[model samples]
Target: MRRKIYTKEQILRAAYEVVATEGFAGFTARNIAKRMGISTQPIYLEFKNMEDLKNELLDLIFSKLKNEIFPVPHTGDKVIDLGLNYINFAKQHHNLYLALYVDEEGGGKKMHDFSFNYFSTLIENDPQYEGLSREQIQTLHTGTWVVVTGLASLASSGSINPTQEQIISLIQRTINNIIAVNETVN
Candidate 1:
């Protein structure tokens, strides 16, 4: 019997769904093939190895983040909404988010850089920060990214047990502190 040709995109999509739903451990050629109703040979044909497929999945996750989570407007408070959205994404897509940021090497670095770029862009474009120096704006952006990422990671991992409201409050306090310090120095 002739084997049906499978596109790489099809394989990646199936693999992503499997990883998202079943965690990284569930990402195997056999499992993906089972899900796709095909044999593992197609996957091997498309990807050099499991690691290559996993890296592509990670890249897809980052693409999703860029499209979905990172475009949130600053709304006069850079930290609050951004942090809320970040935590919400993690909680809502626990397995996928964990796989994207936790289970893979270099995942954290990608997330950190993506987050920093998002925050920096927001700060640079906001009219409220018109008079702030570039260094100050960069500092604020980095501080906000750290606080939000830390809180989101903790919340997602169950390391911090707090209601969403409480988490938001803590984030607000951190942002307020940063603003206060910036004010005093300026």
Candidate 2:
């Protein structure tokens, strides 16, 4: 009798689910194998090692962040809308958000850099941001990202419980302040 072979996609899908639910601590060969109803051998066969699989997962997260989350339809305000979308994504995918951002120590830097680049591009393309210099645009992105990410973290942890409307209000206020300050500086 031949043992069924699992493809890389199958292993990654199971790994993603495990990481989403149980976070990095549970992201092991055994955990993924258990979720897939198979042995660890399939994972080993499909990848060089666990680190490779983890890199692939990180890439997947980055891809989602860029293609799906960042480019979300404009809602009259590109920066604020994108910021809101980020927080909303966190609110919707708490486990996934935590696992990707909070579970691992070194993982966030890559995501942060990716977000910075994406936000810079978004703002540069907006006519409303035309008056702002490159430095101001970068600063604005930093401020908005920090606020929304903090809000998402707190909301996900249930530390400072805020309604979605309240979160949006806070984000709006923050974005307004950022722009106002930048305008004054310029």
Candidate 3:
């Protein structure tokens, strides 16, 4: 019988599956190998170590979010769509969400920076944001981030299972209030 050889992509995908379903606590080479029905040799051969594989996995997941997940237009409102996508992702992939956002050492800072920049860019192009200064836009981004991240964290933890309408209303109202306050302040 010939040995089964796995490419780096295949190994990385298997690792994703492990992390997605089991979270970082179970994110181990042994678990990944078991999920792939292969020995750990293939994983080690493709990557230098578990940390190396983890960094690559983080990049792959971020690429998926930036390219595949968050880019999809929904509800015709960029901010609404972004918030919904984030909440849905947390709801659907609770373990992965917790792993990526909840764990302090899980590169949450990188994810935060990426998300803030992405949100800021969206605001820059939005007509509603046209008159807002960069500082105000940053404030809006921070406010929106608080609302969205709070909802996502709750969703990931199963603390609040709100309907789509409730989630949308909450996000919209919070954003409106923030804008009102920002306008009043300046």
Candidate 4:
């Protein structure tokens, strides 16, 4: 009889699968072990504890998400398109999205910071945003992300299924409102 060998990479992959399907709340040694048809012992042996495995999973998820939303192609409307991309990502990766955003163990600060920079880059590249001051741009960027994240959370949870046009309209309205307020203060 041949002994079944499971490598750390295999375990991590399986763990991600488990999380992707079941969410952070459902994540457990038993679930991962069952996914791989192996004993829970290997999971513990691979990491110090569940937290360690979860941290690794978070890294993997964050990397994948960063790739999905960053360096966003020129869609003629970077801000609106980025919001649509975020919502679509959440809808597709609902469980993973919940883990990233809704789970008690939060790692969303990294995503938040990355979002600020991502929005900043979009603003910098676009000639339309060139007239805005740095502070105004930053305010607009942050406000638009609030819309994106909230819309994503709703979409991810199946609370709403807004069409792309609707999403783009909403984002445009948000950006415009922020600009208006910035002008009012100026």
lDDT of model 2, residue 110: 74
> Per-model C-alpha lDDT, please?
0.76, 0.81, 0.84, 0.80
- The number of clashing residue pairs in model 1 is 0
- Model 1, CA-based lDDT: 0.76
Worst 10 residues of 1 by lDDT: 70-79
Tell me the TM-score of each prediction against the true structure: 0.74, 0.86, 0.86, 0.78
Q: Which tens-of-lDDT digit does each residue in 36-138 have in candidate 3?
A: 8988999999999998999899888988997888867777777888899998898888888888888765657777887878888887888866787888878
Q: Which stretches of candidate 3 lie over 4 Å from their true place?
A: 1-3
Error in Å for residue 102 of model 2: 2.2
Arrange candidates by lDDT, descending. Answer: 3, 2, 4, 1
Pairing residues by index, what is the TM-score of model 4? 0.78
Clash pairs of candidate 3?
A: none
- Runs in model 1 with CA error above 4 Å? 72-78, 104-106, 130-138, 157-165, 183-186
**Deviation (Å) of 44 in candidate 4:** 3.2
Q: Candidate 2 on 17-133: residue-level lDDT in tens?
A: 987888888889999999998889989998899989988988887888888886676457788778777877888889888877666632677777777788888888889777777
What tens-digit string does per-residue lDDT give for candidate 4 at 97-182?
77777777545676567567667877888888888888998898779878988999988888888887788889999999999899
lDDT, candidate 4, equals 0.80
Better of 1 and 4 by TM-score: 4
RMSD of each: 3.3, 2.2, 2.1, 3.0
